[model samples]
Target: MELFAALERDDYEELLFCQDKASGLKAIIAIHDTTLGPALGGTRMWTYASEEEAIIDALRLAKGMTYKNAVSGLNLGGGKTVIIGDPKKDKNEAMFRAFGRYIQGLNGRYITAEDVGTTEEDMNIIYEETDYVTGTSPSYGSSGNPSPATAYGVYQGMKAAAKAAFGTDSLEGRTVAVQGVGNVAFSLCKHLYEEGAQLIVTDINKEAVRRTVETYGAKAVDPADIISVDCDIYAPCALGATINDDSLPLIKAKVIAGAANNQLKEPRHGDALHGLGIVYAPDYVINAGGVINIADELNGYNKERAYKQVAKIYDSITRVLEISRTSGLPSYAAADHLAQERISMLKNSRSTFLRDGHHTLSRRQLRG
Candidate 1:
């Protein structure tokens, strides 16, 4: 990829490449924007086939974070980091500490958390080197794991979508086709099951699918057949691009809401969903629970306050749908419009500042 061209096209603020030979850590950090505040996002570790792929992933994820934070009403911008390696095999204390040092070097232009291949334990490791990390273990007075909070937020958003599509917010008799049964989805399934939603679950991991079936009495389906299943909601808890061309034609769900990031393969797919009268709870808006939970750490993590913020996702989803209906735009476009409007207003209101002064400082600085 032409790196500068991509940055220009995406309006990214900064991108940094970090290499540490001693720990064999090679990572890319992309800060898409800090117009709202300091950039904050998660660190994803994946075994990409090429450097270009990793760069693209970081860029796309960073931009998504900007939108996610903005729409979620956080005083933060968007940034993301990608460590190009196998998390299972390549992770070592030295590597994470080295990565943390790089984050610290930014002086809190960016804050990192856990995503995908990374974990709260990994964030704790990063915390050992710098304070600009969230999702650390509760022993450190942090938010701990964010998956359950994210799952809860998605559940709330799903209920909002259900209200939009089925004239009620209850999932009591809804059949939901779940695309993946990972950690967040596992927690999500529990909520759906408690609400008496029938689940048809599929995952690349057969063991995960089997466990969901056994635990929740969810029906098992072939992974490839999940999109076409007759269901009230299609919940994607897996990777991005699941709502693209092929799957769009097969989806039978009236409501689309899940924890996945970047669900649309392309912008047009969202339009296609809107054309079909499908209610789409924007992925970032629905999934902001995790970030909301983590962002609480910045103000001295409080579970009650964090959960209260997450519960507001229902209202946010309602507003997004209202925007879609009144403006005749896809739900995704409506969400973008809302977020961009916030960013623009904030940008104009704070025009005099060259720096946003939203940096995350270490405990020492906080104490001082």
Candidate 2:
């Protein structure tokens, strides 16, 4: 399980790994390419089943980031970090600082922000050890939590997806079923309500569901029932890979758009959605708002610039639609094609392209 060989299989030239003794911290960083710009992505903390799973996740996620940045029209290329452990039981101040020290060692080959199982407070701890972190506490005058921005971007992108699917950009008179009521989903619900869209929401947290019911009058159902609910748009604000085989047959929505990562069970799932006539917003593209906002903060926190950049999601989505319609390719493939083209352009210009499609990755595989 050599990551560099896996990277080489995909034509990625730069991959780096780091570990920390202070907390038994294990981290992997895969930079698909810096030809576009510095690699920027989030840091994910999860109790992976194995080191091989972590390595596979990091490699795939980093590659996704490249395509995500390219399609989002950002100058940054994609990269990702995964900390292998149960964040709940494995996290501590020393652990974060030790991890931050690893990030500092990168010297900028990779830049990180918060991801699943990591929070703004955790990022602040990392910040205490390194300048390479973003999405810190608001007291630091940074953007703090990114859920609002993420949801806003997803909302905007969802509207565009709705337009492509239903022939109108207005969310008015639309019924959307969302599969999570976390911070991002909360904001997304507000966006839908503001746009005259009715909401059907679900979550494991009773308090979150009850509060949403009390405030927005959203219909609450069990998490399992949310997907099968009949609706215009299905928004997934939870974790990735929710739209796999089991849920695919149950989905009653015309458009599949969500802020969750890794929404597809597999690449072929995108084709299945297309076959079902579902207007799918590729997860990496629609959900990139958080990364986009944090990437802007990388140079300096620029609220206006960040918002302006997020608006491009509309065009990015439009391009996805165009590719899907004209070439009959799945939305995911279209987005990947766009990113691959950009990498090719960069590689030709600088004479430094990593392998693109299934060559090999050249890093040591981690085992949990």
Candidate 3:
């Protein structure tokens, strides 16, 4: 692969390849941008089919983080690290410690947290080497689990979307069809139930579906039937790309907001939603609560402060919808516009400041 060309295409700042023979660590770190501040993202460990695949995943995730952090109004850039191995059987203390040292080598330019296939325990190991890590055990001044915080953000974003689509943010009598009953979705269901929103839920895991049905009084449906269910909102909490061609025509929701990443199968799918007048709370923006909560750890980890910041996701989604209306763009494209606009504004401000600083220095030298 043309590595340099790949980085250039996306304006990636740096890509580091780390290896440790002793611990069998082979990792790639992709830093996509740093205009806002130091890059902050999570490290993911996966059993990728090939090195190229892992590299592509890291680059894609890093770019997504850039937009996620930008739209969430965090002073963080975007970067991601991927360890090429099976998380279940390949994790070891030495491996994480070696990885941590590599992160330390970058100074504070990159900060990492726990991601899929990586846990707080793994982050703790990384923490032992460098402090540029978040999502460690709560005993170490870290926010314990981010699931509830993420759920809260989604719920808030959903309300904003509902306001845009139904002219009322109140979900008291709304019908919400949830496609998964995972930790985050379960918490979201709790919020909706308390707000008097009837839930129709489904999951591949029968036990998970049963739990949601029992606790929140949600009606159980088959996973295949979730998209076509007669509901005001369809919350896809399980898999990515569910909004593809087959499901697009089947979706009956006025608003699509959930915890799943990459909800749109492709960019065009977003346009399809826009054509149908469906209000889509962009996945990364609505699901940024976990990252926001993790980011608060950089300021010494305050629960109240973290949650307060996460609650702003509602405003973020609202702003995205406004941008869509004003720009005549799909909600997904509007989200990208919002993030790019922020980054461009900051870049321009910095450029002007540097130019002014150079003039001041030149004048001072002449006087001297």
Candidate 4:
């Protein structure tokens, strides 16, 4: 890949490749922007098909984190790390410790946390080598698994979307088609079930589906058939690019709100959803609860305060929808606009250097 050209195109700050032959660690760290503060994001461990694919994923996710943090009102920039290996087979204490040392070498330019294939235990291991990791166990005085908090934020965002589309936020009796019943979606289904929302859930993992069905009485369906299912809200708690050309035409849901990232295959997909009168809770805006929860650790973790901040996701969704209506832009575009405006404003407001201290590197320094 043309690394410099890609970074220039996306306005990325820095991208680092870390390799530890002894521990079999091959990782890519992408810091998209640090105008707000140090780049704070999670480290995802996955089995990528190729190194190029891993780089692309890291770059895209890092850019998304910048927007997510900015829109969520956090004084942080965006960054992401991807470990290109099978998490099930490749993870080890030595590998994570080696990775943590690489993070420490960055001198606080990026803070890491648990993501996808990684866990709180992994964060604890990383913490042993560096103090720049969040989302560790309660013993470390950090927020525990962020999935539950993320689910809560998505649930609240879903209700906000319902209010926008159906004139009421109460999901009672509403049918929601959940695309995946992973850790976050499992908790989300519990919330939906308690609120009297009928659930139609699907997942590649049959055991996960079975567990959700047994616990919440969710109706299980084939994964491929989920988009066409009749439902009020299509909650994609799985991976990205689900709302592509093929599934867009078949989606029967009035609202699309879920915990997934990069749900739109392309920018045009967001326009297409808008044309269909679908209320889309911008993925980054709605699913930032995990980041929000973890960011609180920087200020000394407080569950109550963190949850209170997550509840404001509803407000963020409402504002995004309002921007979409007033500006005649797609919801996703509106969210980007809102985040960009804040970033620009902050960049100008904080242009002057402070004598006390600086939490983030200068833009020029970050670019280097």
- Whole-structure CA lDDT of model 4: 0.95
TM-score of each: 0.95, 0.91, 0.91, 0.96
lDDT values of the candidates?
Answer: 0.95, 0.85, 0.92, 0.95
Model 2 residue runs over 4 Å out of place are: 2-4, 14-17, 352-368
Clashing pairs in 4: none
TM-score of model 1 relative to the true fold? 0.95
lDDT tens readout by residue for model 3, 171-288: 9999999998888899999999999999999999999999999999999999999999999999989857899999998988999999987788889999999999999999999999
Per-residue alpha-carbon lDDT of model 2 for 1-368, expressed as tens digits?
A: 87667979987756666777867788887787776777888889898899898888988888888888887777887888888888878888888898888788878667888888899989999999888888998788688888888888898889889989988889988989988889888988988888788999999889998888888879988888998998999998887789888988998899988888889979888889999999999988898888888877866788888877777787788888889999999999998898889877876755433344334232223321
Query: Where does model 1 exceed 4 Å of error?
Result: 352-368
In model 1, the worst 10-residue window by lDDT is 352-361
Runs of candidate 4 with Cα error greater than 4 angstroms are 352-368
RMSD of each: 2.9, 6.1, 4.1, 3.5
